[model samples]
Target: MFFDRKELTNDQLVTFYRQILLPRMIEEKMLVLLRQGKISKWFSGIGQEAIAVGAALAMQEDEWLLPLHRNLGVFTSRKMPLHKLFLQWQGHPEGYSKGRERSFHFGSKAHHICGMISHLGPQLAIADGIALAHLLAGEEKASLVFTGEGGTSEGDFHEALNVAAVWNLPVIFVIENNGYGLSTPVEEQYRCSQLVDRAKGYGMEGVRIDGNNLLTVYDTIRGVREYCVREKKPYLIECMTFRMRGHEEASGTKYVPAQLFETWGRKDPVVLFENWLMSQAILDADGVERERQRIRATIEEELQLAGAAGPADFTFQDEIADVYAPASEITGEIPGSDRELRFIDAIKEALDEALQTHENLILMGQDIGAYGGAFKITDGLADKYGVARVRNTPLCESAILGAALGLSLEGYKAMVEMQFADFVSVGFNQIVNNLAKLHYRWGQSADVVVRLPTGAGVGAGPFHSQSNEAWFTHVPGLKVVYPSSPQDAKGLLLAAFADPNPVLFFEHKALYRSITGIVPDTAYQIPIGKARQVHQGNDISIITYGAGVHWALEFATAHMEIGLDIVDLRTLQPLDYDAIRQSVMRTGKVIVLHEDTLTGGFGGEIAAWIGEHCFEYLDAPVTRCAALDTPVPFNTTLETQFLPKARLREAIQRLVSY
Candidate 1:
């Protein structure tokens, strides 16, 4: 039953008063710091503190909280050390994000709180993933996610809700509909009379409440939590409130109407709750004043401590620490017998072994469950591991990737599959902005491996076929793996899962069925940033990866007279510079080849690296052979001409005869 304001005990009222007061005092102190040149920026939740406090208090200690920058009251209610919050504001090394992020861009694993990125709505899907984890683990806990009215308009918001509804996930989505979305009023944003009304479309229960009413906010969220836990369903609560202050400390209240502030100013949540307490004789005016003084003193001391704590000494090495897994983890060579298998089967076997070994590993993709993915690469995984671990998701690429990030945060390693590499563009924002930057931004490990079925040989057109490894290679925090042989494919995937960072595993569609090699039956991992010298010779150096490796091997075997030193770069991000240098120095000539467009393929990166580091060892200008600057055609003749073996052979001959 929902509790009335009068029903709350004296201790409960006093506790709520303190929870609301803490964030108010903190925001006020931060504004002072902003003017004093001590802090950089501040996003205050001055008038909306009640919503944060109420929702946080309603949730259990173990239930996860996905909070936005304006939800400081939630942190206060959760008993997050005030000094840590101050340290975060000061960007101290001891802060939750380890001095990497600013403001509220921090999370605590101990507290079960997932920090948010500036791109607001992605957290919605991430919260769903956390809820999914809870469901899979049979944990009786729900995830409480906070977003604003502006965030509701984002595509991820709808996608998160839809997925939660379809899967019956336990999540309570709270929308703090505080009149303005960074100066753009609600009426200008969406025409709906009430934001809660949109929940009908997503098949979830929706409720609206006066956000300034602390009792109502807390009771509503408490009830929602019960319903979610009991029914395993998602709920949305739209709290009506106003932004009394500007978006940030630097932004003045000029954009906000003077009348609106004056109207909301009278309905201040802290003052209203305090007045109710006094009316009930729970706490007199003097008691409230004493409480305020105590909070002010506490905040002052915490801020002083934080100010004394200096900034962290961050080096470039620290910034890129999690880019690749530690070499020590690979240990000795993989001990096992070899079995001849197709490239597709090798990848499936690797996934099966990983699932069988690690309880935290999960596979998610479209058609991966019943249909066994687009290429049947994950054919029997669902049947073996059950649908929960091997999940089939809706055609929401961005949401799927965002959920993978959340799953990673919750200590699960997610292997997400993009049916085709070209479709990765649809989810490019999450991959680059969220997945790639998590480690760099907050020192948070994104243990996600995105399996992309890439490249073209069959009659698949532009939408189905693409070689987009270069895009991920450019991202600093991501590890790019494209294996040519079945052995490398199986080994590298195992390495990726073991790594702490995000890895983009590019599985060339052309090599799936056509390529077969001996793969170890026992569990093993190939080192991520090392290259294999497939063929050793001294005349010319052939640098290639993925399907291009096969082409290079074919050409080198055909022309035995020309000694070719072929280097197959299994990992693209951390290129084997030592191997490349030695081969180029010995051969004195180099040929870079790939299936991507010649203009901006990863080959260009290889050529540039060689030019910068191996310039003295060069005998001839480095030559690069790649696909023509056009989309892959549907016609077989044109497709064959598009990826010409003769072109690569001619380039090799020119380099060899140089």
Candidate 2:
């Protein structure tokens, strides 16, 4: 419990004792409440309190912090209301909704707390990207990312660390090594005795500190953070702390060895600091009591406010309102689009027009510059706009998404591309957890567009041929748009670029060259969350989107006897419920199709929506045609069979006969 380190000042030690104890007591109370069933679940940062508070105190106001789930000390110190934290545990919508975020994922634009992410390790990569943004903006600030020892094992940790190291980014990577990762000890998880060594692999100096010693924790972080800011070089610090409680309140402590807890108990961070304070004669009995009383009062007041603040009133209707751009409210018809152009050209023209219109917009991705793009959509952009605006990034998907988020925060409209939609999984967390939730967390809007080449037909297999819209559609903050034809692609890309929040724009490779349609050269934007009726018939409502829309229309048109009403849902997130409901009401029959697997696909969501909202309109059970639940095979014949195609014709024939 005692510390041999002498780097910490007397004042810093006393401050740590005062700040950490209050949060620790509050955490203890919540843990009890969780056991009593009054609180839903609790993820307490108990034994690791000293390091958290110390590090948070060392951080500057402008520096960004991307916190993980176990960030009580960090949040509390940063003025997060404890009541809101409690409300979050109680599952009240207002809990996370009180701030820009809807849960324990607290952050503030004013505070420069980028936000907290529940995912294990991707936040580290985000921190790296934010740091990159700060350096590029020529700001005198850095970014700090805090994670546990287990998080170091994730691929994101490696990617972010390397990027930061290579670029000499203004970032500090702090590893809270609390011995066990959900009951698995450090010995089982890693081969090295110290986690700091892991940072060495990334070409950064890594330091090991006695985390339980408040003075050591504070001094180490404060020193390294300053070094990063001045030197613009990332550093890693391993905080050797321990967990006094279970991972979450729902997880029983029976799995953890009592002996391990006993071993760590001797080095209890709070007790160590209190004893050290007394030993240093920094404070007498009255001083310690006053500090405790002050913290307790602050926590009690916040908790009272949080308990009375009721749940969020926002509903699914709120989801429909914000899918498009905030500044440009171009709603009527597609602008200057009476004539037609190629989809690829439409995409290029849209980008060119958007860049000229908005000075904040930037295009970034691998080979998107002079090469135009992997698909030649961004060709001639670099020459016209300059290389700085149309950036060619390293072949790292996570970094690309992270960089996009950083740029978006700084009022830049960033359009990042994944060479293929299947490759988007590489940056999935940054897209889903961070970029999607930016507006939700800090209430700060991030205008980011992720353009991805999706679907199959050109001999690309599982890795290259994927319609991953379903993955993003399920996420709360993102808006997914899959355009069927070239015109729609142009309109949708422009709309996505203009959107205030994050947009995952999916472009089908099959339609890139094969299915040509007309698009105007002038500025144009397609309305998001609106489905166009491609064909109007009385028999059935075949709702589809993206490349699948073509198949749905072909099958419907081929069968003259069974007329169909085909609705193309251009935007997946803010689904065109009005169009869908109208079609279902008129036809009284429904069929949903997509290029993804049927299980947990977007079609299931559409079917469920129709079942809930238009059950009476149904003539028979709603049928869904989706790709089989297997990887896209390399063989052309197998790929054809795997996708949702003319099989819908057979379904329509059977339905008409019935």
Candidate 3:
């Protein structure tokens, strides 16, 4: 079928027809499966197939594709296996995501496709990161990101576009303005007359077109991709179309106006294309029928195979198994003999060594370049590596983390620093939802290390001083490490960079300058998931981490007559349960301590674990010592009183008496 033989060859025309037909057939089949309860949900690309297929066909094989949930045609156009799609919908083990995710929440590195998370706007920044990597490597490929009209309302969308424009990243943002976002119409979603007009604010080119016309969509995308590659700039295109079906199969079209559907039905893309093909004598009626039958047979076969596949063999342990780096992979030699070093100096040394060791390592944070970091941890790094490697970013925390995820996905390791751990709440979605679940959902490695300067003791108020390690410890896929000494700080930082997953490295603000110990100059990794017994005793065991380690040591020194064992847990998520059990079993009395608030601190988790597993071996109830359940005060006296030291001593005295 070739209506315009001069513009496109007969083969190209046939490919377009096949692309359109595949998604249409697949959409119909998915609806049938939904009715039969073979699939839990179905998102149709009925009237919107042209946008997805056209954009996919226009991009080069090396270019990346980040498609939204409704873009089924992108997968088909990328030559993704039909049976795998069925298996994914059926939640079978052999699927792309290995049955971990239910629907279109997976990506393929082999195919240059970035996966989509439920939070739509976050992917926009991630797409920018992919484009930034290509730009940095001198690659000609651009990244294509898809989103709906509703997603544009999110702050991430604006942040990504603005950064892409400022940096001139080669990214193409395609927004399918399908008239409605779920149930809300476009008029209610935005006050602007046209979404493309917003591009002027970011100093980027914007276009609006008829999304129903396959040829127009294909031409526009191809032109934009070439322009972006040549100019190293971002482009935005708003495709005007309608969602013929419901948001999902379960959400019917009752919310949509019947007259609007009736009006759009007359301009159906498939029907118009078929009529044009027949009019041009490129395809006869019999030829159209044959193509439809062939697609139907292919879908049926895949569906049957997918239906017969077994469920995934998943367990709770699998979700948390790979949180920390394996010990074998962390092996390395220490260069120089041990020398006394401050904790802050040790952290700086680790960064300096890591940057020199790994060529792909890049450092990113606010004021981290020539100005150094907020705490000078990354000072003089930009002077050594230049601004390209040690770059300073904006105040957008979410986009910064999202960009890190994108860079990690493209085979680069990123060492990102949050100015303070308290501000991490701004980027919580990217950390908890995107960074934590990437590997669990699709086996994607987010080799990113986030340095969170945490804890209180510095006269900084509620916004600057807060111990938030307990928040991350609760997440299954994150590796939480808080070091108490200079040696562990240096070693753990190195290990965290070597790890192939996201590691939340919590550096206590109070310990950074106040603590000093011998640290090796050479590269080395302290084994993760192992606790060190600083002192051994027969009376009671004190389990603690971060700055609490120093406090526990002080408490034990004063109470030598009571006899105490000090267990310093450097790693939190993949905790050293064996060490905890052995220490508690020997002492027969346990007390968990932390700097976080007492209500839901990590000490509760430690106490719960001990009570559940070591109840019979214990001589008394497990005691927890943590800060009072109140915001850290600005006054030094109140802050000291609010902490866990007095409470810890009281608990120790009570446990000894018991």
TM-scores, all models, native as reference: 0.96, 0.85, 0.96
Whole-model lDDT per candidate: 0.87, 0.78, 0.87
Q: What is the lDDT of candidate 3?
A: 0.87
Scored by Cα lDDT, where does model 2 land?
Answer: 0.78
In candidate 2, stretches whose alpha carbon ends up further than 4 angstroms from where it belongs are: 1-16, 28-38, 81-104, 249-266, 297-329, 337-339, 383-389, 394-396, 406-412, 430-446, 536-542, 551-565, 584-593, 597-631, 637-658
Query: lDDT per residue, candidate 1, 545-587, as tens digits?
Result: 9998899899778889888899999999778899889899989
RMSD each, Å:
2.0, 4.1, 2.1
Clash count, candidate 1? 0
For model 2, how does the per-residue alpha-carbon lDDT over 550-623 read when each residue is reduced to its tens digit? Answer: 88877766777777988998889878899999999989888898888889889999999999989988888889
- Clash tally for model 2: 13
| Model 2 weakest lDDT span, ten residues long | 318-327
Residue 205 error for model 2, in Å? Answer: 2.4
Clash count per candidate: 0, 13, 1
Local error of candidate 2 at residue 530 (angstroms) = 0.9
